[model samples]
Target: MGKLYGQPDRRPTAHPARPLVVDSQFSTTSVNNRVLVYQVPVNKKRPLLTISGIMSADFLPNVDPQQVMIGPAYAHPEAWVYLPLVNPSNLPRKMIVDLDHNRCDTLDAFLLRGQQRELVHLGTLFRRMPLVQRAIPVRAFALPFELAPHDSAGLLLRSRRSTGIHELTIALSTEKQFTIKRDEEESIRLVALSSAFFFMFTVFSLGLIFKHRLLIYFGLYVFPIGLGQLNYNYFFDAFPFPAWLGLNANSIGLFIIFATNCLFHTFGVAYIKSLNVYGRWHRYAVLFLVGANLIPMGLLLFPLTRTTNAMVTNASLILTTLNIGWLFYISMLGFRVKREKYLLITATLVFVPILYRTYVLDSPALSYSYFQPFYYLLLFGYLIVSLFRRELISQQMTEEKIRLVQGKLEMLRKSEIEQIGRNLHDQLGNTLASALGYLNLKEPRIQVARDMILDAINETRVISHNLVKDDNRPLDEKLEDLAERFNDFSTISFAYSDYTEKRINQLPLLKQQGIYLIVQEVLNNVVKHSQAKEVTIQAFLSEDVVRVSIEDDGIGYTPNQPTSGIGMANMYKRAELARLKLSIDGSVSGTSVTIETPLGG
Candidate 1:
């Protein structure tokens, strides 16, 4: 008993089982070969319609007469299979072998005909084995030949020695019901359509809640699904290339399948999170899934860890499928939660068909399967659900913010009252105290008291005026009055404009006050420090914006030098409160300050 005898109980799987051409031991014993002859069972006057099964064989002392076993026992990735289709008809007939699996890492097949076991050259059928070697686009592989009556041809499958489920399907149909793939052209067209479909999906995903990790993962899922399944069938048919190139094309497509599956599971976790789905073990489960999915990619992508055949990589798919299936199960867990329910439904709709396609069906008879469109539909559904969930969360957050702002506003009001109290005590208390000291009975002292008391009165008026200004007064009128006071007091003549009278009145009182203070601060600086001969203050309005500018022809102070006055800093605080922009630029000749305010506020 050898690799072929690794089968359980030696009961053949299904009636038309694939037989081992050679039987021998694999590990401990090798170099033994035995042949199993078969009489082609004529079906309804036609020869065998299909012959298919799994074959397990070893690499040591490789002897030919390739034997194929019938059972699930030898379904190991490292094990290889041998498929020989014998023709028992009196006349030549076309034989077709439709392989179910992407037969990998195999050499060209051979023809062993008659008792002499005459070896004949295999026709061009398996010549491009290298180029078309990949299991990517799970192709509809059919080995067709015109076998002379009583002729038998076989395929030698030396699958890559790796760990994972590895098997093949061999379908043979005699002349009567046999026909070339009817949808071959359409299938190729479908393969070509992948680019267009992928592009559209990418654009759509970008347009919708792109910031959301869910959309990002969905995009990740879609890209590989489209790129990997792009078998070289259409491209090569239209513009034939070298055999090696074809083989690479297949390999790349195959790589895409596993990679896409891994990424797809990540997208599932993102979906769960977006729906706010949670369980004690949910994150742990998802993290575990992510780790498992990445195993294959880590091994294959990292050059140092990769093997030539990468048969172990097949386990990646098994783990990936299990992870994906687990994700589906998790989605079901969310069924009771309303929001999560929709996400789950959409996920189910998306993944169920995928599971079906992977586990049950063959490569479609159509131009690619309709699975992509279904995937797109599901991806889009998830996108919409994600966006809706995000918006709902945003609304909740906004309400929370409003409550916080109300509390902050109340605190601001209390601070403002405290500020007014300090201003009154600091400014008025000192002047009143000084006036009280001058109050004496003597005539000279009485005169001093009269002067001091008058001074105190003036100080009281100034403090009151500053603390309480009628903000409703038009901004331009206030500026006009400012110009009058400055021009009368300062040595420098003042030039002013009032173009903002209409626009400035439309703004909020707080904003108008802020603008007014900025202008006042700028002018006061000019009077105290600048030795200017002339000054210009302008209030200009344009649409929604009002600009106040004050310029001095005085010796400008250096910006790098700090001033002891809080007047400028006070002006900045006011501008910040009102959301206005204040700028001050100075040179050797003078200083210019501009306060720009928006009327819409």
Candidate 2:
């Protein structure tokens, strides 16, 4: 070996003496061959660095070299390396270099070394980055280089990116192996992303449909988190982004982290705001936290320099600690409650892993967030389940309330019917008996018997009116009772639709009373004159109006025909008194009457 550029000729001290082919059992890919490694400083300025002392390792999925004990520059985003491109065989090799885009932002490689070196911007979102290269799914940047048989050249590589730590990787592989691995990984990622979004959408839609506040808050909190997951995982790098976003890997990551934190705090406050269990002071404290999170979130929008980066990093640690403490505190306050218990478990599961990644694993070679996807997935699933459980609980409580109310109403209804039956038997029955007794007299006391019969008729009418009278019960119930009474007296079938009963009941008592009376008069006419076999009644309430319709399939009467009965006249008088608009349509086959009134009327 001879030195180039007048530098010392030295072999990589850490390189393995023999090539070690890792077995498939311990590997993530089919081929896990060891590759030589080197490191260069961001500020070194020189094209290559002294690489004889760097650490090295075999290509294994679960193992990596220990962190290099180096100077401060080792943690900088601009990382450089020198790969000794060697072809020991007689045949030439077209080798592919793969970098996990999640680990870094931009990748650049130089062919040859010294004066003859040519620069290649392999992994980047800039205009210069090749469109075809952007299509690769797994690697952040895949750079290809060629070497003649039994020849070698120094390939210099740089990664201008960082994922909170100085870690970066340069994986070596044959072209065919790289393609197969990329496709397999791509399919898996698409499925995972699709499922995650689908779950998110489901929870969000439920929140809207049911109007569950906690689910709504949870949905809002998780949206940005999902986006941040994609951003940090390098999923977005597969597509081209507009330059106007002013984002590289690091800045975008910071922005997303800050935004997610802000939203989490905001939603956290909203979730607990109405819970009296947290107390007034705790609510105020949470509000303060939301305001506090906004400070860091706002600062991140400005141009980022080293000062901003350091500030943000320190802030993140402090804010994350506070967030965890808040979760624990809430769990303690509502420890007996199911929702708070879930929060406690979730916090406990996530807290330790984040601490381990942030503090214990301080290496540039290993991922700063190896367990990120797992923990975040855990959080997402747990939150959705918690919200659904809460909704189900609410529904159960509502149903219980309805059952209680219905039970009371049933008892009251039975009592009223019993009272009405006694009145009919005691009062009306006695009056009719007296009238019959008067007729039984030989001379018949004709006038006295007639007066007794009239008194009995009046008493029966009053009893019948009382049965369908409105009091504490709903207007629809009163109308339904009226229809049932009419059905008992005649052969006609009566149907009533109260689909908008809830809305109709919201109107003033006076309006409901007027509506009930008008409907009563119309039904009487259908029975007396229309000779209807079937009758249908429908009521609807809109934003500012109420409408009710009654139709009968019968031998209808002419509108202009003279009638001795006053039923039609009574309907018109009642509608006019209530300030309602009334319309009557009659044909040989049927008669329809509709009443419309403004809500205020």
Candidate 3:
């Protein structure tokens, strides 16, 4: 017998119960005619290169191709199967050859003619076979072949470079059987794609409604993710575009996938850390991860080749490790800052499976099977629900704040009415009574009674003016004017001083008015009850707050005692309403009332 190429000079032996033969040689050819052609020694270390038993159309589907060991013998990055098939029929027949591997990049076949004991290639049966040879998304390449009686041919199945594990499976069937199988598989893929799209749409709609950028980022991320998955699963084989666009669909799809994926991570980290929840080191680490993720995308700019593909794969593996480590690190930091815990947990939980499916199990950072799209759908659902919950919580908090403000306003209104009533009765009623008593005296002192009646009228005017005072003036001017009015009312010497005049004037108009009212009430108490000979109004700044203090050299009362004075009570209530702090310190020499207001508020 003639010696075959890369085979021992002996007749190829067939199994007793099977018609399959072994040539003790294997070769993998690239589309550009680059070959990693080598021979596998017929020893225990060599894996089964060909299937045993009768190679019939019915039995081909059940034949499982052994895995190509990726050791020193087959160390090249690019690999595929070079299976030899024999025609076992006496009658000439036409058959459809199908290579069913989702991760396959290309598939082709060529006829083999026998010369002595060797098999030689005749001509190309097909080259760079289309992935979608059918009308649907079934990931199989089917080609029609005509075989003479007892003639043989070899099927060439080419797959992308295997970074870790690799396997191949082949099927031979009639044209009708291939159509039926393709249709059946197409239905399953369609359902998966539809479900993935539904989730994507739901997430995008929620993002539009809420206008949350986190959800929007996620929605955009899913688009390229779906494309990358389709590309990885050989869906792009049927619609191969020319490289005139600088990059084909495969490379472009992968580029977008990694780019968008990195953007998602960057944006997510930014959104969560927008409040400055994490520290500078965490941000620096994130920047490093971003740079690492970007390196792989830059590598895609090179032409798609075995070496370039391997480089991209190694870079992606590094990125995957960095991403996983970064997630765990961020999760650790998330525990320290409670606000980000939910976000960290959700992201880590959702992305763990996705990264595993994309990088660890399937292709790294590029392609995935049909099942991977649904993982994105799951992530989308999580983001939508989280945003809704946050919105609901924010709405509830706003409503609660409004209700509390209303209640405070009601209390302030009633307190003001009582204070006014007390002032009227205490000042006007007493003056009128004194005047009547003097006029009804036996001597009828008309001049003295007239003076008393005039005093009562003046008191009424003062009360009316205090009820509606002009508030457009600056706060320091208002304070000085108040002190002047109080000095006119009583013999208590009034002095106005402002050390932080600019700061006081910068306060909001509402706050200035509130401070003015509080000071008026405090001085009123000093005139009516304290019998103070001197009073000083002072304004100053204290640690992030503005303080207005009214000190009187009056008979001070006990601090804890419940006073019946409406002026003191109203002062406290007004301070509470204005969101200011009020404190009164009384000593044997004097009483000091201070109103402390936040500078920012």
Top candidate when judged by TM-score against the true structure: 3
Candidate 2: regions farther than 4 A off: 1-75, 83-87, 111-130, 133-139, 147-155, 162-166, 232-250, 270-275, 337-340, 361-375, 382-387, 390-394, 409-601
Give per-residue CA lDDT, model 2, range 352-447, as digits (tens).
565554445432111244235545665756754775687579888968966875565455456557756776787688888888998999889879
**lDDT tens digits, residue span 395-437, model 3:** 6796797688678767876877787798689868988999999
Lowest summed lDDT over 10 consecutive residues: which window, candidate 2? 1-10
lDDT of each: 0.51, 0.59, 0.58
Q: Provide the lDDT at 488 for model 3.
A: 72
Q: What is the lDDT of residue 87 in candidate 1?
A: 51
Tens digit of lDDT per residue, candidate 1, span 1-601? 1222122333332222243222111111111122222211112121111212222221222122222322221133333333455555465665444433333323223455555555553432232343354321223444455566555655433323122223333344533333434255345547445654555376447637446566566666767655543432323222344543323322443455566666766667765664465555877776776676556545444331224234434444456567657766756665554445555666566666756644543211111233355445546555555655665588679679668755654555465556546645765676567667766434336766677666556545444444545446777888777777676545668777878657777787767766776776677667657889999988788877888888888898676678755556666766776778888888998988888877667
True-structure lDDT of candidate 2: 0.59
In model 3, where do residues sit more than 4 Å from their true spots?
Answer: 1-78, 84-105, 111-140, 146-154, 158-177, 229-245, 274-276, 295-311, 328-368, 379-601
Enumerate clash totals for all models, in the order shown: 15, 2, 0
Best-fitting candidate, scored by lDDT: 2
